[model samples]
Target: MSGTPATALDFPGEVVTQAHVRYVALPGVAGPLALVTLDNGLDHTRPSTFGPAGLRSLLAAADEIEAHTPAVSAVAVTGKPFIFSVGADLAFRSSLRDPEAARAGIHAIGELGHAALRRIGEGHFGGRKVPTFALVNGAAMGGGLEVALHCDYRALSSDVTALALPEVFLGLLPGWGGTQLLPNLVGADRAVTIAIENPLNQNRMLRAAQAFALGLADVLLEPADFLEEALRWAARVIRGEIDPAAARAPVRRGAVWA
Candidate 1:
């Protein structure tokens, strides 16, 4: 679905997820790395989610990263302590009564997510072709997992137990690029298992090891120092010490994927 650029929407009692940007200097990596932390200002019990306001917040963070003076060499997006994000705010969608309005809202939301995330995968940060990383330190479901898929590389924490595109189980689809990007990443067969089969079969989610085995994550890290290890790995990759594409599965396209 497509629509005009998304504008922030107001909803009662919305727990707005805020994107906080901090620049980190990783050893052996040139220039500063823009690290975005997604938080909703609540405990882990309440996972961060993307509503209109939250999506706007991420767009604003992207703006900040683009506007940095020295120009960020790399970008990384992560979540709070044990939660990245759980995707769009279902509470906001459930409150809508008009079908037309719901359709418009869904389109707007999907458009916003695409706008905010596509740049990372495309290396379009202020016209500089820099790599992006998704340091998945915790649970990443639905749109959250889609966010990781948009990055050049993903580092998943071993402690993560919930990672899936459960939208099918909820009678919805992964409208925000999951359907297309996932199949391209892990092959159509594995992507079907993630986007369709597992969700249909009791909404099964992937632990970090399972996701790694399925080629969803480029690296699996321990939770105790996931952030640090991820940074080191990124530095190594940046310095030509590690080759990310070497570890990835061969790309399948044309009739092979079909």
Candidate 2:
């Protein structure tokens, strides 16, 4: 199976499964898959992008997931131009814009992402087992990386894919789950080091092999073959060849930023 391979119904009718948050869900080669595609090559969903009514609809839409979601055996998210995710919407941070409104929207939408992620992880597809895989197709930092962390497995792109929690640069830590999940995947020592090192550009980001070596990824494969390789991994999980593990919270970094 491949990353969210589209399937056809027996009647050849178009099947549409509305995804949650800024994310979208579709059938993969093996099971149900969701994709967290970045908008305009940037991170976060636009406040102006989804109005209050629209947000309500999108958030409430997950209920249907309990009814429509299939067994999630594989998933992949690609950032535009080799960038996985740029974190939350820049518009949300523009102080001169509006923090109050942004905060409200964040709370509202954040809850949705939380539930959607949990559903993806726990929701059942059939009498069999379910597994989730995240393919860090490119640079995934901050919130984008947080999203990747939620998956049962993460496979970063071998081609210079940088992962980080740069929320400190913005005078914040990853509020989403980066602070916790990152260290859980790689370990407190390496996670803290990556954060403090503060690699400036994406080019400086670690590749999949290094990530795997760091325990961040299970394997490292070429970008050209990323999806195919991910499918291979997913198949193993589906076939009971792999067991899932829990991720831990990142230890608090002391004076590293100061």
TM-score of each: 0.95, 0.64
Give the per-residue lDDT of model 1 (tens digit) for 1-258.
Answer: 122284556677679999999999988776888999999999999999988878878878887888887888888999999998889899988977799988877777878878767755555665678888999999999999999998889999999999999999999999779998999899988999999999999999999999999999999999999999998888887778888878898977767687
Best-performing candidate as measured by TM-score = 1
C-alpha positional error of residue 145 in candidate 2 after TM-score superposition, expressed in Å: 0.5
With candidate 2 superimposed using the best TM-score fit, by how many Å does residue 97's alpha carbon deviate from the native?
A: 3.8
After TM-score superposition, what is the CA distance of residue 62 in candidate 2 from its true location, in Å?
Answer: 5.3
Which stretches in model 2 have alpha-carbon errors above 4 Å? Answer: 1-66, 69-81, 95-113, 116-129, 199-204, 243-258
Please give the lDDT score at residue 139 for candidate 1. Answer: 92
